[model samples]
Target: MRAQSSATGRTAKAVTPPHAPSSARPAGRGAGTGAGTALALSGVFCFSLTFPSTVWGLESFGPWSLVALRGVLAAAVAGAFLLMWRVPLPDRRHWAGLAVVGGGVVIGFPLLTTLALGTSSTAHAAVVVGLLPLTTALFAALRTGRRPSRPFWAAAVAGAAVVAAFTWQQSGGALSVGDLYLFGALLVCAAGYTEGGRLASRMPGWQVVGWALVLCLPVTVAGSAVALALEPVHWSAHGAVGLAWVAAGSTFLGLYVWYRGMAGIGVARASQLQLAQPLMTLAWSYGLLGEELTWAAPLAAAGVLICIAVTQRACD
Candidate 1:
C-alpha cells in the first residue's frame, strides 16, 4: 500500500503485508466507473497495436534501438506537456514508486517484449501477454491492499487460464526463450501498472506518466545513443510510422488514460478490462502483420469476454 500521510514528512510503509486483508473495493457501478472502463478500453486498443508496430519497427531498427528510441521520443513529448502545464515535482515519498514505474513500464516491458517479438509472432506474443490483467491484479492486491472478491478472482483466473491454454496450444506445449521473455515482461509490467495506479490517485494520470518518463530521460537518452551506434539502421516509411505510434500513442497517451482509468475505478477492477487486449492484438496482427488467425482465437475471445463481464459485476 502507498504511504498515506500528510504533506509533512513522516515514516510510512510502502507495501502491504502479503496476507493483508482487502481494504479497498470499487465504490459502485456509477457513471464515473463506466467512463473509467471506457478509458481503460481505449488504452487497451492503443496497446493492442504495439506488437505489430514493433514488428514494423524491427524492419529498420534493432530491438535495443527501437525500444530506447521510443522511450526517448515518448519522454520528449511527455516533457513538452509537463513544461506547458508547469507540473510541479512529485513528493519524495512518491519518487520510489515512480522509479519502479519507469523501470518496469518504460524500460523493462518495452525491451523484453521487443526482443521476444523478434522471434515470436505477434499473435503468439499477444496471447501470452493476455495474462497481464491477472498479474497486475495480483500486484495491486499485494501493493495496495485492494483485495477483489472471490468471484472477481475466479473470473480473473478463468480469463488468464483461457489465454494460457491458448498460448500453450499455439506453442506446442513447450517454452521458448521468447516465452520466457514474455513472462518476465508480465512480472515487471504488472508491478509498474500497480505502482502507477497507486500514484495516479494522488495526481493526474498524465502527470504520473509524464513525470515517470522525465525521470528516466537520462537512461533512455544514453541507451538510445548506444543502441544506434551498435545496431544497423535502414529508414523506411513503416519503420517511421511504427516508431511514432509506439512513442506517442502507446507509451504516452495510452498510459495517461490507463492510469486515469485505474484511478477512477479500483486497480483490480480496471485491470480486468484488459481481457480484451489480446483479442484486439490478434485482429491487428492478422490485418497489419498478415499473421494467421487461429481458430482457437474466437473461443478464447468468448471465454475472456465472459470473464471480464463477470469480474466487472463481481467488483460492483
Candidate 2:
C-alpha cells in the first residue's frame, strides 16, 4: 500500500501536476501502511455517494450539461478556497498534469457516468463500476513495474465474475450498451484516482484537487458554453436543487475528502476500499429509484467483499 518503487530503485513516475512533489519512499513501512488504509476507507465512502447524487441531478439536466456545469462550479469553489487560503499557484510544469487529471476526473468520468445512467439503472451501473479496483491495480502495475501476487489477480477475476453474473440477472440476460460505457468510465476514473493519489501525497489534499480544478477551468467553461449554445436550457426548481446538491456535496465536498484520503494513503490500498461503493450505490438505487434487488444483489455483494478481503490480505 505504500508508494511503489520502479524496478531501477527509483520512484515510479507519477502523472502529477508540476507543483506536486514526486512520490516519496516511506522511511517506515508499518506506519505508512496503517495510515494508507484509513485514508482509503474514507475515500470509499465519499465515492459511494456519487452515483445516487448523479441519479437525482440527471432527473432534469442533460448528461453533458450536468457534467459541464458541475466542473465549472467545482472549479469556482476550489478557486475561492485557494484565494482564501492564499495557496500559491502551481507552476507551468504542474499545469499539464493537472489538465490531464482534471479532464479525466472532472470532465470525462462524470460525463460518461451521466450518459450511461441515462439508459441503464443505477444498480447496473454500480455492479459494472466495481471493476475500478482492478483497473487501478493494473495501472499501478504498469506505471510502477510492481507485479501483484497471483491471489490478487484471482480475487479480481472472481470479483468480475460476480459482477457480471449480477448484471446479467438484473437485466434478465441481456446486456445494455450503456453497461459497456459505464465500465469504460470506471476504468478512466480508476486511472485518475491512481494518478491523483500520487499528487495528493505531495500537497495538501484540498490544494491538490483545488489547483487541478482551477487549472482546468478554461476547458470546463468552453465545454459548458458549447452545451448552452446548442440547447434551450431551463433550470427548474428540481433541477436547481439537484445541481446545488451535486455541486456542493458530490463534486466539491466529495472530491475534497477523497483527495485527503488519497494524500494519506497510496493508490493500491485505496483502490481496495472502493469495494464499498457498489454496495452503497445498490442501497441508494433500491431506495430512491425503486429498483428491485434481485437475489444477485446479496450474492454479488458477498463475492465482492470476499475478493476485497483476499486482496487486502495479500497486500498485507
Candidate 3:
C-alpha cells in the first residue's frame, strides 16, 4: 500500500516544475487527518452493536440464515445507493480485490461470528473481538508489504496484551471454542478491512463497499433462498429490527467510514483506534441487555485508550 502510493506521489512530483506551488499538497493532509479520526470512530460506534444485534437476531434465525439474509438485505440497500449515485462499477483489475473484500467482510466475518455467538455469551464474544485491532494491523502490514517499526510493533503488542488480559480476566482465564471462531473472524475481517482501505484510496469509500455488496448478491441471494427453503424461519418483529441493524449498519454503512479512515490515515493507525470497540460494546450491553457493568470496565477503557494514544505516536 505504501509503496504504490509513495511511488505515484513521487512520479507526479517528478513531472512538476520545481517552482510550482503544489496546490494538492495541503488539501489532503490536514483534511485527511480530521476525516480519518472522525470516520474511524464513527465506524467503531456502528460496529459496537453487532453482538447485541446478533443475540436478538438469533432468537428467530439460524446462524447460516442470519448471515445469508443479512448479506442479501445489505446488498439490496447497497445496490440501490450505488445506482442512485451513479457510481461506476469496478474494472477488471479491481475484481480480485473486490472479491477478497466480499468474501472476508460480506461473508466470512459475519458467518464466523454469528456461528461463534451461537455457542458463547455475548459478553465473552465482545471481549474476544477486542483482538480485532491487532489482527487488522497484521493484515495491513501484509497488504502493504511494509513491516512496522520496533516501537510500532511494541505499541501494537501492548494494545493486544491489554485486550487479552482484560478478556482473560472477564472470561475466567479460559478461552472457549467460540473464542476461536471469533479469532478466525478477526483474521478474515482484517484482510477485508485492509483491502477495502486500499481501494478507498483510489475511489469513494461508499462506492467500494457498495460494489462489494452488489457483487455478493449471487451467493447471498441463493444461500438465503436455500436456507429458508430447508429450514423454516419463525421471524419476530424484534428479530427483524435486529437483523436490519446488522445488515444496514454493520454490514454496509459502517464500512463506508471504516475504509475512508483507513485510506485517510494508514490502516495500522486507524486499526489502533479500534481498541475502544469492546468498551463501547460493553456500554451498549449494559444499557440494552440489562447486563451488569463491571467496575473495572472504565479502567479497562482508559488503559486501552492510553495504549491507542501511544500507538498513534509510535506509528507516526
TM-score for predicted model 3 compared with the true structure: 0.86
TM-score of each: 0.90, 0.83, 0.86
Candidate 2 on 1-316: residue-level lDDT in tens?
2223323444433344445322222212233566656656765666676777787777667777788888889888988877754455554455566666676787778888888888887777887788888888788777667777888788887887888888777767887778877877877787777667666655556666787788778887998898877756666765776677677666667666666665555566567678777888788778766788777775687678778888888777
Q: Each candidate: what lDDT?
A: 0.85, 0.71, 0.78
lDDT of 1 at 112: 98
* Model 1: how far residue 310 lies from native, Å: 0.8
TM-score of 1: 0.90
Error of 3 at 256 (Å): 0.6
After superposing candidate 2, which stretches have Cα over 4 Å from the reference? Answer: 1-35, 168-175, 232-238
Tens-digit lDDT track of model 1 for 1-316: 2333446565454443354222112212233877888778888988988999999999889999999999999999999876764445667878899999999999999999999998898988888888999999999999988788999999999999998898788779988899999999999999999999988877678878888999999999999999999999999999998999999999999998888888888789888898888888888988898888778876787678778889999998
> What is candidate 1's CA lDDT for residue 1?
29
lDDT tens string, model 3, 129-239? Answer: 777888988988888887767787887787678768876787687877787788899988998988888887775677678888988999999999888787667789768
Best by lDDT: 1
Error of 1 at 65 (Å): 0.2
For each of the candidates, the C-alpha root-mean-square deviation to the true structure, in angstroms, is: 7.2, 6.7, 6.9
Deviation from native of the Cα of residue 119 in model 2, angstroms: 0.5
